[model samples]
Target: MEESPAAARWRVPPAQTALKCAAAAVFAVLAALSDEPGGLLLAAVATLGSGGLALRDLLAPVRVAADPGAVTVVTGFAGHRTLTWPEVLDVGTDERRRFLSTTRLLEIRTDDDLYLFSAFDLGADVREVADELDRLRAGGPRS
Candidate 1:
């Protein structure tokens, strides 16, 4: 049987989500076991923040999916955004450098605004995603 196009959604790897939850659990346990006076407060705060983020990421996740007619982006806390081929003006890659580390990002430009999607969420190479999006916008094969 052939899978539906909507079933081909892309999302952050489950391993990453598991890692975040494990890290948060470790911090939470450390916070509970901390004995230092001032250090205990800081550790507890960090545990709470980390735990919250872990829960959010696990629940919402980050995803990008494409159908024949449109693309969908779900950036966890950022909510969902969709754009049809006609709405897309251009699709390309953008790079950011900080110190010795560099990161590349996928960008989509529409008539009204430009949107950026992270490769982490797409679970694929940023360049590949950008190229595929460009092809899709040009009315090429969805794959």
Candidate 2:
């Protein structure tokens, strides 16, 4: 069967989400407790900034795809980066405990430059995606 264009993603880790929730809660309390307007303003800024980062992360996993010839990372831009089989030279395990099954990192050395893909920023299904990318790149995807 032909592959669908929709990018598949592993969901974000619960630990990360919990941490973000905690930070937001703390920041909210700080903002509320502040007696001076400046303190409140700072707290609000921190809360908003942190929330923005979290939102960016939530959206990133939805923008990636792996195929036999290449692993395409969609940047939601006019142009996207593609890592060919040959470009993907090695995989790295970051030894970080953030997600469930994704690799720590994937190191790619293309004809032109080197690229590193880290799953620490991804959700739950990264391991499956990585394995699929490896298989497809090695042996073309099943028809």
TM-scores of all predicted structures: 0.78, 0.53
Clashing pairs in 1: none
Clashing pairs for predicted structure model 2, backbone only:
1-143, 10-125, 11-123
Worst 10-residue lDDT window for candidate 1 reads 1-10
Q: Number of the top candidate by TM-score? A: 1
RMSD for all candidates, in order, please.
3.3, 6.0
Candidate 1 residue lDDT tens string, 4-42 = 543335567677778777877887788788898677787
After superposition, the stretches of candidate 2 with alpha carbons farther than 4 Å from their true spots are 1-29, 36-42, 74-80, 91-103, 111-119, 125-130, 140-143
What is the TM-score (0 to 1) of candidate 2?
Answer: 0.53
State the number of backbone clashes in model 1: 0
Residue 123, model 2: lDDT of 52
Candidate 1 Cα errors over 4 Å, as ranges: 1-8, 75-78, 111-113
